[model samples]
Target: MDDLTCDVAIIGAGTAGLAAERSARSNGATTLLIDETFGGTTCASVGCMPSKLLIAAADAAYGVRHAAVFGIGATATIDGAAVMRRVRNERDKFVAGVEDSIAKIPDAVKICARAKFTGATTLELSDGRTVHAKAVVIATGSAPMIPETFDAVKDRVLTNETIFDLATLPGSVGVIGAGPLGLELAQALVRLGVETMVFDKGNAVAALKDSHVADALHAILEKELPVVLGVETQVVPDGDGVRLSWSGESSGERHFEYLLVATGRPPRLEGLGLETTGLALDDHGTPTYTRETMQCGDAPVFLAGDADHDRPVLHEASSEGTIAGRNAASFPDVTAAERMVPFSIMFTEPNVAVIGVVPEDGAADVVVGTASYTDQGRAKVMACNAGLVRFYADAADGCLTGATMAGPGVEHSAHLIAWAIQSGWTATETLALPFYHPTFEEGLKPALLAICHAVHAKPPPFRDDGFLPGT
Candidate 1:
């Protein structure tokens, strides 16, 4: 077998893997990244980039067909094929760009030829070769989940993997989950005139945010893609179309024509050399990381991306990968034992974004503020009545601790809140900061105001911080 070596080796070339490689290089360290596909998920194929691109196209077509909503009396027809072509072209350009970028990295970052571990410090390539590295980072991104319960016939059923390849919209689609993937695809399909139904076993889609914010999202999405919010769906063979069985409770059980499973992801550690390392993996089959610093304990191995903990998002994975790569370059991360990691979430339509924590989650005190969409300076011009911005403060010092938002233009507000929380600002200071008006950003007002108005009000007694906790 051929033998190889590198200072640091990364198992995936997705966003996280690439980020690690880039970060490692900047730190003047040698690194290597390996994956079956160059761009991994979002940048290349079926992750956020391509999905959002198609959704944007569908939204554009919808706007064209429904111009009356904007007070412009006009009639327009949609050409799905033309819009799809634009989406494909744009997606291709992005994937190509991602590949071209990673290729440009210097020799310090040597990409392996698809290697899996045969030993603790050694790996076997696809072509009967061997390699060794001082350290290894698992950035292997997740694949679209296709549970075995569903019929596996290629044409009749599809996973998130095959959905993007669809030539034309189906008459109806029963998406099998309510999370980001399912809802995103379901919404896009409906916008393109496909009768789409988003089915989920539970309310896991955008479930991490406040229930009030989720209600707002539900209302907006109900206007288009009908959500089977409280259903426990099971897939079976149904001749031309698949059959999905789910308890509708009051509605009993329901079936569907097409099925798209966007349930969750399994780590890509099977063929790779996890057996060679002594890392911790659960029965659910996820690699565990040291909570303090993301290290895999004694071994020179670290886990990032979906393989790290199944929170499958491009941005989070990439951020983790960069950290892993940086730590790998510096031998091992002994310093990060005290550093805290941040969490980020993204969504469609008034995008549900949250950062920091409520008093219930941690610490002794809490502060909150809010700004609503209807009262924004530009709400009149936009004719919008949706969106809320919330901020949390530590009761002891009145310092900003966390923030969350739902509405248009909250993208900028997420950054503002993140900075305020990380910078240790107080409610009074944040309120005094210059905030532009007539935008969804107006939502940030209420949470900060709450911090000031509600002095002794502590957060709930319990802290159920799922994804991120502000300490």
Candidate 2:
């Protein structure tokens, strides 16, 4: 067997792996990045980038069809084959870019073969190669979950992994699971003129913790497409497509030309041979790793990205990768710091987003500030007023804790809140920042004002003039 050595060995060359590799190398570690395939990931290949492309096309179609509200009547026709072609063409460019970046990394430090652990610090490749490293970082990503019950009808099931490869859109689709992936593609497909029905075992879509925000998003999505929530779905083969039967919130039977499964993604650990490391496995068959340092026990092994199942968003993956890489390079002396304020966004219509710490139920120290886009100036002008924004703050000090919004331009608002929370700014500090009028941001003013009022319930400190500077 061929032998190789490195200061840090990173498995998987996706976003998280790349970040870890780069960070390790920058820290003066001799890094070896390994992956069976290095072309793209769920993000570049099918998850975020390609999915957004499809969404953009669908949005255009939706905009044109809604132009009648602006007194401009026009017919918009969408060709399924053409839309898929455009999506593939654009998606290929992104994949090509990732491939090109991988190519730039010298082959001497990159291995293009499947690998598993032969020992705690040794790895065996599918080819007759072995790598010995001081530390290892498992950045292996995740795959879409396909239930075994759908095995007979697997040919008709479309996942994020295979949805972008479709030559043409199906006549109708039934989406299982109302998470980000399901709601996003379902809405896009519906807007593109495909009959779509979404089913979820839970009452919430997009995993919104705030009940009001969840209700608002559900209502908005229902106006565009049919959504069945709090239902368990059973699928079976029916001719060319599949038949679905679900019950809980409602009982229903439906047949679709295609079925898309968007259930949870478990950590991918099939062939990695984690037993070799002697690290304890979690109940989910994933390695026990700390989110703070991404370390897997005391074995000098780190896990990042979807493999860790901590925070699977693109930015969070990058951040975790950086920490894992740096810590892996440092080995037994690795150090980790507090994570940044958590942030996430789902790019649906009237985008859903959250930032900072979300308060739990019956939290007496929490105060909620609210606004509705239904009468917001910019939203009314854009004719897309169909959601709400809510901010949560510590009532004791007006410190912004978290926020969840289901309204137009929430993506931008989420960024603003993230920065404020990350910087430890309170509600009053954020509100002091200038907000332009007739803009979507101005809609946030009411919420901020409400928070300021709630936190300042007692007499104003300035009112005690005896101790004031002027007095």
Candidate 3:
């Protein structure tokens, strides 16, 4: 009800907003953090943690059912209700942690209400309170994208926002969009004994850029559940379920009790009243912002997290929030340069990972180094040898630039590759690092060696000799 003034005003109390708030405060700015709801975004509530819990449960069920590979005869049964209950229970703990963090922030500085921009440096709270600030950060985050075509079956359609809330698993599920979320959830659903299928307009699965890696993932996921790609899908109500028809001709239509639209997430920029800021909006309606500084424009306004739609992962969001917050607090005085290399991981069976600069297949400046689980001793022994890892390096300098892989332990490999790339490690130098025998990391050696060869880096005599047992 009163007019308040602060050095910085941070809209949205999600992960990015929280980070920005702390960073701005740490930088000696009187910061006010506002949000209609507390806790973080998709990661805590329904996105990352809950989905991973479901995936883990599904993986355990799959492993037990297929235990005959090691000559163990055991019948595994899954309780759909129990599995979902456990997922939600664990998911709540994470959500509680986020709330606890928000609780620790002084109440005097945090406002639980929708904030609308009244001016470039002013926010009007829904409760009639006005905030006149020197700088502002926008971190409103994003929401699931539901296509207009699915309006016929809107009641049956679910997104990550609602899927985890299911009290019981659907008898059948049709996941529309074979991106990371769709593919991972489809495989988990299949393992949980719920008949599942995935459809995506894009030819690629799990957002993989590398054709070879994408092909491998498509094949592997197809083995678990039907993956329909490169076709438009239509959903119509059929009794209590929904019947799906695609662009291509088919004799029959498939029906599912539930439909998951995991196509993508669009920024939540509807009600914030952006017209007051005079900041340019991108083609996607996202505020035009710089990657290096996170500044919306020449003004002391910033955008971070899913709001920016750049590298929407949690860690990247945090980094961007810190940058935005620090810069907002010190506008026109300091702007930090972006130095972190890009990194992303999809936690599916034999996780999918992309790190650094993904080069084109036949790029003249980059060389491709590839290795398959079929040749890796550890993967073969584990009976999970079904994927590939490919690394891209600067051909002229042999510096490791990027890596894309769909294989066991790829999450760890992705981290290592991202670190090496960020640290400017050459392929030869990475190959020289110790790789123990009969380990998944040993698989990386071959790829790095291939890159060294492509770059014409002469290796030491021991590596050249047939002395290596695995080689």
Candidate 4:
């Protein structure tokens, strides 16, 4: 094939790469989208969609099992095969949607082959074609990190990349890592009647930085499955299964049909011949880039999405891609873009979400407001009354800074808090907004009110209709 050239060349066809391609094209730049395979996004293929499908099934089973609390007699026999079949089937639909989007891009703009950097503005294709571009964007998505300790049980190990492909749910699973992925999957599996246990060397759960929220999550998850934290765990292949032995919080050995490793995902940057680009690399081999501009040093080459190792969630990836693409198209005249407030959610029952700034322990400049579902009216009505919600505000100004929460309807409440923080709303301002009565969202009011009082910014007195005056 003849040498290919474009004004902008984007590596990887995942969420970030696709967004970069669109942004570049819309910016009046001719672009080449290169990847080993097209139309396969991590979110659609294995990461978000598939996992959610499995979680949905698990939630159904849990609802059925706990129906008695609602004064309804119900029982469920989970068909593992059927459950997985639906997961795969629905997951394929999501993948197809991504493929359909890729199909809409002009053929001349898409390169169905792997690419490696030959120079700052040049790439060599695996198929023997060379491309020289004015600017480049690296969006190669990440892969699950498998620790070297699990090498002995490699055959029995399953990461997010391979776990969804199981033909049937395993009889038992030992999850290594207490992060969101591990805990979410472990809980789902246990709810589906599989014996599951989670182990982690750290003393936290999910991505929560607040000790209170982390402890609440750990406690809630433990009621469903054994979550052993702060432990030194050893794994080894034992016949057809894997044996996990831990000594720290407790000492015991257990065997499971499979070990799910959800430790973390590092950017997939290996073998990309980055040294030829002459860009400075960090200790972890990632190119040094400014988050605001996504430019590597002063070079035309840019990094986005998981490849940059900054906020690997889908939305952040897309946002980074847009910024990187536009900046790459603009080249040396690149402009920096403002970033959105950080927001993330784990789809556990009574979701876990962390938004914006998380104050350190005993931070004098931060005031915290808290609420517990243990006595929340709506939560008690739904029989899901357990978890904690906390809002952190600037002690000096009472402006909402961030929040870490693990509670019923937190996924929605977190968004509100994140928006309030982004809009520079203070506790008084946020409390002025209406909160419906007897709803899970109303639980957020107590926390906001606490912030108002803590920061010495009391809300206005309620009017005759029992509503605080609008700010």
TM-score of candidate 1 versus the correct structure, residues matched by position: 0.86
Runs of candidate 3 with Cα error greater than 4 angstroms are 249-252, 460-471
Residues 350-446 of candidate 4: C-alpha lDDT, one tens digit per residue: 7999998999988999999998888878888889989899999999989998999899988788888889999999988887888777788877877
lDDT, candidates in the order shown: 0.67, 0.87, 0.87, 0.90
Q: Which digits, one per residue and each the tens of the lDDT, describe model 1 over residues 397-441?
A: 667777667777665668777777777777766667765544555
Worst 10 residues of 4 by lDDT: 462-471
Which of the predicted structures, 2 or 4, would earn the higher TM-score when compared with the native? 4
Highest lDDT against the true fold, candidate:
4
Pitting candidate 1 against candidate 4, the one with the higher TM-score is 4
lDDT-superior candidate, 1 or 3: 3
**Stronger candidate by TM-score (2 vs 3):** 3
| Model 4 stretches with alpha carbons more than 4 Å out | 463-471
lDDT at residue 84 of model 2 (Cα atoms)? 96
Better of 1 and 3 by TM-score: 3
lDDT of 3 by residue, 1-471 (tens): 679899999998888999999999999999999998786666899788999999999999999998999999988788999999999999999999998999889999999889999888999998999999999999999999998999999999999999999998889999999888888898899999999988877888987889999998888878888898888887789999999987753324688999999999888889898988898988887788788999887888999998888788999889888999999999877576755899889988889999888887788989999988865778878888888899998889899989998898888877888889999999877766667777788878778888888888965445641325433
Q: Against the hidden reference, what TM-scores do the models get?
A: 0.86, 0.95, 0.97, 0.97
Give the deviation of candidate 1 from the true structure as CA RMSD. Answer: 6.1
lDDT for position 189 in model 1: 79
